[model samples]
Target chain A: MNAIEIKNLNKSYQNGLKALENINLSVKKGEIFALLGPNGAGKSTLINIICGITKKSSGQIRVFGRDNEADYKKTRSMIGLVPQEIATDSFERVINTLRFSRGLFNKPSSDRYLDSVLNSLELSHKKSNQIRTLSGGMKRRVMIAKALSHEPNILFLDEPTAGVDVALRKTLWSYLNNLKKQGVTIFLTTHYIEEAENIADRIGVINNGKIIIIEYKKKLLKKFGEKKLIFTINRKNKSINTINSIIKKYELKQKGNKITFNYTQNSKKDPASDLLSELNKRSIRFQDLEIKKNNLEEIFINLVQK
Target chain B: MNIRGIKAIYNFEMSRTFRTITQSIASPVLSTILYFIVFGSAIGSRINDIDGLNYSSFLVPGLVMLTILNQSISNSSFGIYFPKFSGTIYEILSAPISPFEITCGYVLAAASKSVLVGIIILATSSFFIELSIIHPFWMIFLLILISLTFSLFGFIIGIWADDFQKIQLIPSFIITPLTFLGGSFYSINMLPEFWQKVSYFNPIVYLVSAFRWSFYGNSDVNIKISIFAIFFFLGLCLVLISMIFRSGYKIKT
Candidate 1:
């Protein structure tokens, strides 16, 4: 059975704004699924609904095969959520916050486990300090520590590394990877495509309150990833007509003396040798040659735009 | 509400309240001293006796209740409102803590503050006037019950309010006026016949009269009626608060 199942999920605000429309997805256990989207793409809304923080306008949700509405307590205990905002009670100490969070999940207090969590998050030294006195990055770490205190099987991180510095982001990613290795299912939402590309086994792109696509990271990249080869030649070349005819024969675009060839990596036929041989046969000399492969950012933009 | 969750929430809330001990304790103490100087000494000089007791003595129970009521309202409102304003409420909501546990934690913390302030005011009043508790157990019981009732009311207000201005609306517009007109400083008998009839409508009057009866064995309203009124208001506040929690009103989308 899937770790989480969302069926025809829908959410609308009281002001008559529909934030999510018919979202349906299932996450298997022990997998890292990244939900990628732009601002206001309903990523946070979806997380809130599954975490039982927000009421759904319609549809059904289950966690560990338990219905969220009917067995909210059981479902809630199985998941830990780190929200998008940097939220912490500033007056409480770090250790106290973690303890409270653990207890909230009905987990009995264990100093040994709590200490390990604090040590792993590098929050041991700041345990007794007030949260208000901690730096921003430290506070964010405290939030992660709090979420992990209960040893939940499933963890949800909503824009977890947003606004974090490079070093901290790298450390957090490594820590999350370690957690994943320990058999925890991580469901994350992030604006940083690189984070998703680095960590996710599967990627789900959401745009305008709809899930545009959900596919294995490798398969998605292979299917939608576009690469282009560009050739810049002498602008004053007199054999432009001959070049245009040759380019047309090879199905390439020629503007002035410059030519660009677009192709997918998964194409059965290799166009590189053919293009080079054709250029040589036609005696076409290019000033510069460049090949560009589309990154996750480009893929995301293209899907969102669509 | 989960028992463990409630305990966690209660501890978290109590720790936060204790962190601001100076503000929580000093404000009520200072306010009570000022009340004694202005109303007890200055005003009592001319008013003489009220309800067969010295003006200063008559004002003790009312003043203590006022302090408790104000602290209860401010503490509870600020307790919940700050979390909302700072966005920490989202963290709490996301955690496994249920809404019922959250409500109880905040209301109980506020009630604890109110009880502490009540005790302080009662202790300080002894320096200014010869105060005696006609029924010690009743006084303590009524003080706790009143504080809990007001704290719960404040919890509802905090949940319903969106901004700082909205949080202050109840204290400024509703609580302050009701407190002043509830026969805190003077008896309802002093008011004109028509206004006396109107004073009966004020719910705070029942709380104040009940508290006074606990102290002096004298009450402006019947003792049984006052107790009934206190329970009725307490019950009403509890029901409203429970409904707000169950519906996730103002806390959820």
Candidate 2:
């Protein structure tokens, strides 16, 4: 069974503003799904609704074949959420807070499991220290530890790396990788395409409360990634006629002494090597040669812009 | 239904009380003692007695009630408001715990703290003034009742308020003033007949009168009426709390 299934989800505010319009998506078990969106996108609203923090205007959400509202207790018990905000009671000691949260779910007190969670997050040493005394990164990790203290099967990270330093971000990346290996399905929403590109098995793009596209990361790259070849020719005006011919043949663009060609990986052999040989025969002595493929950011921009 | 959920929330809230011992317990206890020193002794030396009781002794129940009212409102309001301000409330909202359980956890913790503060203030008053609660059972009942009621009120104010200033506005401007004028320091009989009727409009007057009656077996208001007022306010606060949760007020997304 899929870890989560959402159907025809719609959320409209009291002011008659539609925050989510018929959002339908599913996350496979033991797979990492990254939801990429802009600032005002409905990423958070959808996550919050699934987590039972926000009510849906009209929709059906099922986790493990159980209706979210009908079996809220069982559903909530199986999922953990790492919110985007760094929120913890400053004065309370870290260990005590985690224990209390574990108890909240009516889970039996298992210090062994709690300790393992803390150790995994690198927070075991600071367990007895007050949360306020910890740095921002530590506190964020504590939030993660608290969420995991209950030992849920599925975890939802709502912009987990937001405002985090590079080091913590890398740590969190490996830690999440470990969770995925343990068969924990991860549903992540993030603005950082690089983070998603690094971790997400499948990418879902949402824009203005609509799910624009959802596809495998590799497939998305293969389909939308535009490969570019550029060369700098010393003599621009001399090569104008040859450059025009190449532009017509390969659909390239020229700016000053630079010529750019776009191609796909679908072609056999090297698509740009023949063009390179052609340029050599024409005596366009270009020293600077570069090949660039469109990153996830470009793909994301192209999808959202379209 | 989720008793463990309620317990977790309750214990977490109560831990904050011990963590900030000075702010939560000591400050109020010390202030209550100072109230006795200034109002009980300094003013007692001038006026002989009121309602056939020593002035210092007569202030005991009123002072205890005053502390409970302030403590109950302040504790519960801050208990919920701090989480909302810091954004930790999302965890509670997302949990399997129902809204009723959430309210039970926070309101119970706040009430218990207020009750403890009331008991401590009562013990403190006994040091300087010779006292006897003629109806000890009634006194305990009223203490718990007032604490629970005001704590719920504080919870409402916490959810109603959107910012720091508003959290403190009602308790300072409305509750404290009403308590002071509700015959905390003196009998309402000292005022004219019209003022006595005006004092009846304040809910604190009924609480103080009922509590004072349990102390001396005499009160400005009838015992039955006082009991009715407490239950009435308690019922209203409970309904308001349920409505607040249903409406998904400031706490929900």
lDDT of each: 0.88, 0.90
lDDT of 1 at B61: 92
Off by over 4 Å in 2: A229-246, A254-259, A267-291
Give one digit per residue, the lDDT tens place, for model 2 in B1-253.
8898899988988888998889999998999889888988887778778899988988998889888998999889988898889998888877878888989999999999998998888888889888799999999999999999999999999998889899899989998999999998899998999999999999999999999999999999999999999999999999999998887888775
Q: What is the interface RMSD of each candidate, in Å?
A: 1.6, 1.1
Worst 10 residues of 2 chain A by lDDT: A234-243
Q: What is the Å distance of residue B231 in model 2 from its true position?
A: 1.0
Q: Give the residue spans of candidate 1 off by over 4 A.
A: A229-246, A253-259, A267-269, A273-291
Docking class of 1: medium
- Candidate 1 chain B lowest-lDDT run of ten: B90-99
> Which candidate number would show the highest lDDT if scored against the true structure?
2
